[model samples]
Target: MSTLTKSNHIGRKISRIRELKDMKQEALAQALGLSQQSISNIENSETIDDERLIDIAKVLGVSVEALKNFSEDSVINYFNNFYDESAKGQILNNSCSNLTFNPLDKLIEAYEENKKLYERLVQAEKDKVEFLEKILKDK
Candidate 1:
């Protein structure tokens, strides 16, 4: 099924998440008490053990479900709706003097983070396609 396919690329998802977090293989290795080569192999592996995946996700500051369900389009859609509703609230409550904290700054930070992730996701997809094409050509 399409749903299964979308959630199946565990290694790719981990690599993308690491890149989006601005982490290097060496950094993740350090966090997990692994060598850089081990981290590299993990990222290249098609399947990883559940416990190892959980540890890696913790080092990456994400949940296993997030890694499994990650899709750039879904992230973009979530932020779009979130910011739209946020803007509407601000517009409707422009005169509300009771609001103590400003959330726009945090929202902007999240948006920038998402933008970086989107760019990395696009590059990763391109790299995957090129890798597949290379294998096909070699065969």
Candidate 2:
């Protein structure tokens, strides 16, 4: 891919990530203080400003680098190739449906990690609010 195409691919990656998280464009727009149409435009753009990318990543609960480099196919391929169940006699039918890499455990683990991270973010926000309130009361 050319540099321009590669840059545009980042927008697609962001769109995919948002979809995977079950987040609507309207919700993302609300978080970014933008309109849904604006979010659509951003997803169709070739590039985004670094600061804006950071803001979007924060709203998505992911790192900016993750947004930049995320690939759904890579994750699927990794799981598909990581385990060979047939070789271990786990696949008796030898059917495509019986082919199992068993990525559900990893997905669950990632979900738990994200939940903890979200809780930490919420606590940090609460702490910031309390600090600000304490300062106002002191004044």
Candidate 3:
């Protein structure tokens, strides 16, 4: 008789959302000006006041409704389908996409940057030698 209703554990939802956002309890506590122990207590709570929940939502950068509606299954689904509709149904979430990126072009760009740096270094050495020559001539 106890298995059908959805869980309304607001604190648990908050905890999950915080973890998904890569935030630690200590960081969240600092944002809310509360101690870590207080954050722990809040997470262990089954329900939070509306005002407190709104404050937590602000710190987490989510709407209060988003916090309340957070679900592990939904998150998993969202990440598992990370392609944009404009991609023509191409799976663009990883390196397996059929994009036209040339590694040789990237290598050439790196070489050009390195050549500029080498030129700068050589000019600096020449400048140092010139300064030293001036000093020796003065002596």
In model 2, pairs of residues that clash are none
Per-residue CA lDDT of candidate 1, range 1-139, in tens?
4765655668888998899789999989877879999998998887899999999998887889998877777868977987898888755335346645476975787688679879999999999999999999999
True-structure lDDT of candidate 1: 0.84
Off by over 4 Å in 2: 1-8, 78-139
- How well does model 3 score by local distance difference test? 0.84
Question: What TM-score goes with each of the models?
Answer: 0.55, 0.52, 0.57
Q: What C-alpha lDDT values do all the predictions have?
A: 0.84, 0.81, 0.84
Top TM-score: which candidate number?
3
In terms of TM-score, how similar is model 3 to the real structure? 0.57
Q: lDDT, candidate 1, residue 72?
A: 75
Of candidate 2, the 10-residue stretch with the lowest lDDT total is 91-100
Itemize residue pairs with steric clashes in candidate 3: none
TM-score of 1: 0.55
Q: Candidate 3, residue 25: CA error in Å?
A: 0.6
